[model samples]
Target: MKFLLTSGGIMNKSIHDALVGMLGKPIADCNALCIPTAMYGHPWVGPGVKAWEFISGKEENPMVNLGWKSVGVLELTALPSIDENRWKPLIQETDVLLVSGGDALYLCHWMRQSGMADLLLSLNAVYVGMSAGSMVMAPNIGEYFVGWTPPDGSDVTLGLVDFSIFPHLDHEMLPGNTLAAAQRWASGMRGPAYAMDDQTAIKVIDGVVEVVSEGHWKLFKP
Candidate 1:
């Protein structure tokens, strides 16, 4: 599995290049399987839509521009109501899984409710996350900041990785309080905690993690 988790979309223009560098030219050539969980009802869905189009060579919004196969976008309204069987085809046929940033709590809740949690975790696919998309993949979601709330109860996360992650670290609302909050929150956890500022990313490949881009990343231990 491969991951490109960025600190929000402070520098999205480099995301496609970063992804290509991580996955290599062969895999990068495959269609872009985008999961825009963040902009479900937001007004700025255009960028997410156009990014996929630029990457996959798709002309329309509803179409998937698969270079060899066919590429398409799978818009998820509410995760709880989606059919798992339907995703099998999409997941199996797609080359990459691009997860856009949104509300971390809502995204996690929806993934679990939709029953896509286990399936998504098990797949040996490429994972690309921005902002909230980057946070949900971590163990415990970052402390609520940037208007994204944490899910109630034990809706911690998918635990895809052992660390707790904070995205959009430089946003004014976060600043010093973000890492301080992360340290406090991780006080009882076994794994470490991390925060990546905007325009930065942390790439994990074959169990090895590295911070990419020109920024500072913090890792805290209990």
Candidate 2:
């Protein structure tokens, strides 16, 4: 599986090329299944949450607007009531699983409960993640900025990657998510971690990892 985990969506030509390279097909031929469950953590609250709401409401999603022929929305929050026969085929036919950002813990919870996490690994597709989308693919997001709600039991993620990912380093709107603060969090992390600004992305193809950045990023070790 290939994962293009970005702090934000594809923000530049380099990032888009990295994505297209991984997709291995014409941009117009790529079919996407977008999962926006993470954005549900504090639905209807906070600046970030409200902003995401407006974006998703728009007819042309940023991901699809890039050139994908079609985007099928799979509200994982509604997974419990959906028909497997209908949705499973959609998953198999899709060329990409595009996950948007929100609350990492919330997304992971529904993913596990609804079996999305397991279903995804079985496919050979490009997993495009933005913000919290990138965070949920990690083993854990150890004390990331603060105020992130914990899961019912553990703070575990999808474990799609071994290392932790810290996004939005030094973001003006998110003052808590700064370089100095991320370093402090990294110092306490038990394993390796990477911190990135919105213009950066962590690409993992098979087991190899690469940093694709248009702005700034850093790696931290215990």
Candidate 3:
């Protein structure tokens, strides 16, 4: 039940420390599994093999610096279809699961179909979700931004957490994700929503939620 959800992966010392602390062991002793499946959602261009190259070439990816004994990158979507059993053992052996960002809907597709979403609570490891990774864990993803929409006509609730997370708040790269947009999005929400910038993260452990950040964030309530 340890979750470290961030906009950008480990952007500061606070987030890094929080993640390590959640592990409850020296980070050097732990291992991780990186799932970059979200990168293939809508706007998923090019051949499928190109997507694999992008993930495999992340030798300098940020997930490597968190002090894990090893950070293994495995594109969930690339795995053989209908074979969660083949990868369940690998997932169980890891100390952390780092979900990469791209498109929330795309990520949700692989997680739900792969049965990874159901195995989450039972795993004895930390779940680190960045951007889209954070959104897919919500009970329901309301209309929040221009992209990252859930499937058409489907509630598609992962039910992993009670609230939805709007990541990359005030981030310069995404002009549509301004504070005003977040307010507007939250205004229509059925429940609470959390907005976080790259330097921020929301930590949830055993139902107790905590804000861990080195930048700005907001908790929007309905």
Candidate 4:
């Protein structure tokens, strides 16, 4: 699987270009599925208008709003009740998966429960993740970002990537997300980590990772 991990969803031309490059086609020609499960788990974002906005392409993030050939919702929380045969093929056939931001641990839980986590490694489609969506790919989100804890009550995530991520770095609205805060977060990670602004994204294809940014980012290594 290919990854286009962003703090914000394709917020800038560089990130957009990286996504297009990964697709190997124009956005208008591809079919997409937007996963809005994470939003429901977040206290500040869910069970209301916010989820509707993300699905309807009314959110500030440039995700579902992208002109795709088709866009469908793949709510992870609801997948357990349905038959796998009904949804597995749909995922395999989709060109990309647009994942929304919320609680990383919550998203990780559903991803596991829904079997999306297992299926992801075998897919050929691109994955576009925003904020928590991106962080869920890391080995761990660190204690600072933990919310909606799993059964084991650990900060661990999917570990799809080798490094962790500190998203929305220094955003005016999230004053606690300063570089210093990210550095402190990284110290606890005990591994490689990235601090990225909204205009930045990390691209991973065939195990090679590259930073695609129009804003600022820093990489901290243990």
| Root-mean-square deviation of every model | 5.5, 2.7, 2.8, 0.6
Write the residue-wise lDDT of candidate 4 on 36-95 in tens digits. Answer: 988988999997999999999999999999899999999999899999999999999999
lDDT for model 4: 0.95
Can you tell me which runs of candidate 3 are displaced by over 4 Å?
Answer: 42-61, 78-82, 146-152
Candidate No. with top lDDT: 4
Cα RMSD (Å) between model 1 and the true structure?
5.5
Where is model 4 poorest over a 10-residue stretch in terms of lDDT?
A: 38-47
Better of 2 and 4 by lDDT: 4
Per-residue lDDT of model 2, residues 42-152, tens digit only: 443333644455235442225646767887788787877877787888888889988877788888888888878888778888998988889888888876533456645
Error of 2 at 56 (Å): 5.0
What lDDT is obtained when candidate 3 is compared to the true structure? 0.77
Write down the TM-score of every candidate.
Answer: 0.71, 0.90, 0.87, 0.99
Against the hidden true structure, what lDDT does model 1 obtain?
Answer: 0.62
Model 1 steric clash pairs: 64-71, 64-72, 66-71
Error of 1 at 193 (Å): 0.9
Q: Candidate 1 lDDT, tens digit per residue, 46-85?
A: 3466444434545332213323234456555544566667
Clashing pairs in 4: none
lDDT of 1 at 188: 53
Off by over 4 Å in 4: none
* Model 4: per-residue Cα lDDT at residue 215: 96
- The best candidate by TM-score is 4
Query: lDDT tens digits, residues 18-69, model 3?
Result: 9889998888899888777886774642236535543454433356555678
